[model samples]
Every structure is written in C-alpha cells, then in structure tokens.
Target: MSKPRSLSLAAYRVLSWGVRNGTDKPYIPRPEGELIWIHIASQDRQRVVEGFCQRLRQSRPNLSVLLTAPPQADLIRWDASSHPLVNLPSEQTGAAREFLDHWRPDLGLWVGGGLMPNVITRAEERGLPLILIEAEIDIHVARGARWLPDITRYTFDCFQTILATSPETVRHIRRLGVPASKVDTAPPLHVSPNPSPWPEDELIEMTHALSSRPVWLATWVQDKEFISVLSAHRQAMRMLPRLALILHVADMSETEPLHRRLLSMDLRCVNWDDGGTIEDTTQVILTSDPENLGLWYRLSPVAFMSSSLERGSGGRDPLTATALGSAVIHGPFVHRHQQLYDQLNRAGAARLVRTATELGDAVVELLAPDEAARMALAGWEIVSEGAPQTDHLIEIVQDSLDQRGQDHAST
Candidate 1:
C-alpha cells in the first residue's frame, strides 16, 4: 500500500494534543494469543461488528476480539471472559502510538461508518493488516477537524480492503483515489449469530412427542413477567385448545417457584429441564436452561421474547429465535435491544405487545400457519441479510490471522 498523504496530520496532531480526557481507557492488559482489534467507528454500527465477530469466532473458537469505540460509549461491552470493550485511544499522535505499542493486534478491523486518521495511520505504520467493513459514502471525520482538508482518500489507503455498503460507496471510494480492486460492495453485519445445529434425533423426538401441536415459546421469563406470560397463554388457549407454551425461566432459582405457580393455575405442567415429556393434556412445558432454548427455537414456530412486560427487565435478544425461523412476540420495554427490535418490528418480523391480551392476540395471530411463516420468513431475512458478506469478511480475517501466525512462528 502507498503511504497515506500526511493531510496536515502534523497540524491536526498539535491542535488536539495533551489533554488526559474522556478517551482515556482503562489499561486492559492485552491477552496472549491471536487477537483482532476492532475499532467501532460509530456506535450504531457496533451491533453489526458484534454479529461479525460472533460468526468469526465460530470458525476460530479461541480467537480473541478486542472491540474499541469512541468515548461516548453506547457500544455494549463484552464480558471480561470474552474481552471487554474500551475507548479508542485518543486521536493525539502520542496516545495513538502508545495504544498500538501496547495492544499489537494480529489484524485490525476498521468498522467504517467513520474514521480516526491518527490511530489508523499509526496501525499502518506498525504494519497491522487492516480491513474496513460497512464503508459508507459519507465520510465521518473526527470532530474539530472539518476545517482541515479532507484526507479521507489518504486514510482509505491504509486499509487492505474496504467493504462498501453500496455501489455508490464503491464508486465514492474509487473517486477518493482508492483502487477498485480494494473496494467491493458488501452488506452491513446485521444482528444474528450463525444458526447453531440441533441434534436431528432430539428435534424429531420433540416433533413426534408434540404430535404436531401448535407451540409457542416464552423464554427468559422473569418472576414479575411470569404470570403475565401464563395469563397470555391461558387467554390464547381459549382460541386454540391445542396450543402449548414452552415456558423458560430466566433465573434457574425461580424455576421451582414458577412451576408451583403453574400447577396452582390448574395448568398441566411438564419439566422439560428434568427430562419430562409433554403430556397430551399439558398446557405448559417448563425449562430453565439457556442451552435448551436452541431446541425450543427449532420446535416452536412462534416465540415470545419475555422479560419486557415488567419494568427493569431491559428485554432479551430476539435474534436467536428469529435466526431459527421463529416468529417473535415482544413487549414494549425493549431498550436493551431497541435497534434490533425496532428493525424486526419495522420489517413485520416481530410483534410488540404491551399487555397480556395483546400478547395473546399476537400469539393467536402468528399461530396461523401462513401468518407464522410470513413473520418467520421476515425475521429470517433480517437475521440472515448480510450472511454472504459476513462470510467473505470472515474468510479474509481467518486467512490473515493464519498468515500472521505463520510469520510469527518463523521469526
């Protein structure tokens, strides 16, 4: 790659220097292994970055991902075990150099709704293999530097590849002097994990056990939302007597209490978590394990993403159920996964219910084979929208990491 034009970086560096401020991230010692350092250029694009990382890890289980974002920090942090997110280092030259020296990544992913000239150039100086994903035509330059001449083209040179969001973006990148070969269109990394495979025997057994019963899953249910879910089930049952609810408790400790409450409701309950099978008259099948959700997602054509009807539940992720072709019913309190829910709702992939009656209505409506299939297909389209692009990005990362590993081994 040709050297990035300085674009008055010297003046910009001097102007923005020497203030220990918001961009100061905690000193998270870099983990020992092959690590991909991702700069989430914008918070809105973080979900796509996460979805990409999740799919990438499936191919490389022990791969470490260090996600970084600007100091405003709407991007969700990963758990400590996985690798927590931190602020992107200050754009000042010194901080940029220090950050690169500290966390020498195997590959650098520039999640490009924006760009950070200083750090990106620094990464290039350090010979990091950089790839920009979700490249938008409108370049988002860092604040306080719009007065500076547009160095966007020079910055673009630092990347090994740029995956543009559209043909327009691809054209724009070329207009900015990026080589056509290095810029190609790809879809945004929309939310959804790669669909996990369930045991064929188990799926077949669950199918035969239900004898083609109309099933809906109510998963990640909190205690406060428990009765509302059950009430919704009872109300929906009035319309379809054969409907069954796979009720999963978010907290395992609440499992027994919830089970007792179900029995008190005069609902026939079976503990699927304890190897219980659904009886012919069973109205509810209970589970507490999150792993079991995969099986249930496959079994049920419709699912209620629980814990939202009650305040402070913050909502659960609906992507997994949607990824498995399950039409979703969610409540209004979806602040945690708001973007995802909004997209699903907008696409008619998910229905939002504020009350038991509404939920019951949604369940009944989605249960109609055509309605359920339509909703599920809509959800699936959203879930799998960027799949081919995601695969291409994954391949590039994998091949680069492998080559980096080989180079290190030889040295």
Candidate 2:
C-alpha cells in the first residue's frame, strides 16, 4: 500500500479522537460466513443498495451482507430477516477499531463516497477489499485542506475501485489526482429490471379467466383505505362494466374480515387466497399472498399502489409493478418510496390520485388498452435504462469477492 502524501488523515483523527461514536454493538453476533459490509453515505441510496444486495445474493448464493447508514437515516424496515441494518460508528479511531473488530467483514462497499479516514484506513490496514460506487467526493477539500494537505486523495488510496456517477464527477475526482483507471463513470443505481419470478401457469390461468377484461390492481391495501378502494372500484365500474379489481390487503390476517367487509359493501367478489374462483360477474378478486403479486402485476393493466392513500401506511415500491409492465397509480403520503414515486410522476409513467374519486377517474382513464400501454412503456424505460449499469456493478462486486476468496485461500 502506498502512503498518503498528506497528514490530513492524521490531523482528522486527532481532531475527532475523543468524539463519542453513538453506534451501538448489535445483539446478534457476527455469523461465520463470507460477509460483506456496505455503508451508505445517505438514506436515499438504501433501496438501490438493497436491490444490489438481492442480485448479489442470487449470484453468490450463501453470501451474507451487513448494511450501515448514517445517523440521520430514518429507513423504514422491510424484509431484513437475512440482511441486518445497523448504525455506522462515528469516524473516530476507537469506534472504527471496535466496529472493524466486531464485524470483521470480508469486503466493504462505501456508496456515495462517505469516506471516513479512520474507518477506511483501518479497513485497508486489515487488508479488506474496499470498493467505492456512486462517488460524490468533495474535491474542493483537495485545495481547501492547505492547512493539512490534499484531503480527498489522501483517503481515496484506501479504495481498490471507484465508480463515479457522472462524467463531471469523474473530472472532479481526476482533479484531485485519483488515477483515471480507478474512476469510471456509471449511472445511479436503479431498482432491478427483472423482478422476482411468479408461477407462469397461474398468470396464464388468470389471463384465461379474465378473458382480457380491463383489470386493475390495488396492492398493499390497508383496512382504513378499504372504503376508498372499494368506492374507487365502484366509480370506475360505472364507466367500464367489465373492469375487475384485485384488492390485496397489506396484512394477510385481514383477509377473512376484508372478504366479509367487501360482501357487505355489495361488491361481487372472490377470495383467491381461500381458493375462490373468479366468475364472469366478479368485480373484485381479494388476496393477501405476497407470492401472487407478480402474477397480478402482469395480469393487470393499471395498478393502484395502496398504503399511500392513508398515512402511516408507508408507500410501496412501485418498481416491481413498472418492471412487470403495469402502469402505476399512487397517493401523496409516500414517505418510504418518495423518490421512486417522484421519478415515475416526472416521467409520466404514473398518475397521482389523492382521493378515491380522483383515483377512480384516473383508473378508468388509464385502463384503456392504449393508455395503459403508453404508461407501462414509460415505466419500462425508467427501470430498463439503469439495467446495464446495475449489471456492471454486480459484476464488479462478484469479481472483487472472487479475487478475495482466492487471496485468502493462498494465504
């Protein structure tokens, strides 16, 4: 390893020496396996990183991942049964040492370039292979650090590879004297274009049952929004008598009660989870099985992503719907998936409906074959545009891990 040309890191360590690292040790001990540590500079990158992790798991099979984000990150929990998220210790020597010792990850990935001199240098010293993606380095610090020396280049030596988000970012990194070969321009991470697979026979059967009727899906619907969704379906049906709705409750346990509730609302319905069949007169198909979502996404032309209609029900990820070629409809209260919903809205790939009446109008309008196809095309562009970039990053990570495994074996 080459020595840093400046004493900036040393001065930084001294300045932050006594700062208390607010991060706590996790209750779960480190499992014995090949673990990769991923630290994000901000919370917005959490979903993208999680997507990358999913692909990584598919490739590596048994690899474990540990995710860390800054203190300001208020990430809503999702399917974390396997991957664990924890607070990253503050960039102090003691905290860094304790964290590195406790986790002892096989590899580390720092996203959006929140380089901590203490943590990064320590990791490098321990021979951890580190990769930096979506680099957003503060290059002004290179000249601003006249008191100590070039700061950006000083810490960058720790990373084995660095992929910048844009050509402008590449120029900025290059100006700081980082090797051009190490800095490649890559696009921002996106939700994977390929979603989890569903049973194809079911999609075929559902397609046959529906007989190409104008269909819409309301997924992750909460109990509070039952009336709103039901009312929306009723209003839409006034325009298109053949429109069918798939009402998926967020909580599966509510299936029985929701079924009973729909019956009371005078809506002709079928409970798919209870093995009820969709009849020609069926206006609503109810389900809570997550596995069936993929089938519905492909079957439906338009999807009203529920949980956003009412507050406290964090908005659902719309990428799956879009990736599977369904036009998206969402509400205003999308705190969890704010960025994603905004992206779709801006691209004209999705419609925003704040009320049941508005949702009904939008659904009725979008369910037209041509209208739905146009919107689904727009959404498909949003997800597919980032596919090559995501695939490249996956390859980078896989190669790094493979090389590390070989090195460990040799030693």
> Candidate 1 lDDT, tens digit per residue, 102-157?
88888999886657777877788777889988887544445677677656776787
List TM-score per model, in order.
Answer: 0.88, 0.91
lDDT of 1 at 130: 91
**What lDDT score belongs to each candidate, Candidate 1 first?**
0.81, 0.82
lDDT of 2: 0.82
Candidate 2, after superposition: displacement of residue 127 in Å?
A: 1.2
Model 2 residue 194 lDDT score: 63
Model 2, span 1-411: residue lDDT tens: 445434677676666564344455453688788999998787787878888888788888889999887645664465322588887666566777878898899999989855667777878888898889888874222122336665557667678888887899888877888778887877778877467787778778889999968899999998899889989989999999998999999998899998888888888999998899998889999999988788999898899999999899778888889999999999889888899899999999999999999999999999888999999999989888877877888898889888888988998
Which candidate wins on TM-score? 2
* TM-score of candidate 1 to 2 decimals: 0.88
- In model 2, how large is the Cα lDDT of residue 392? 87
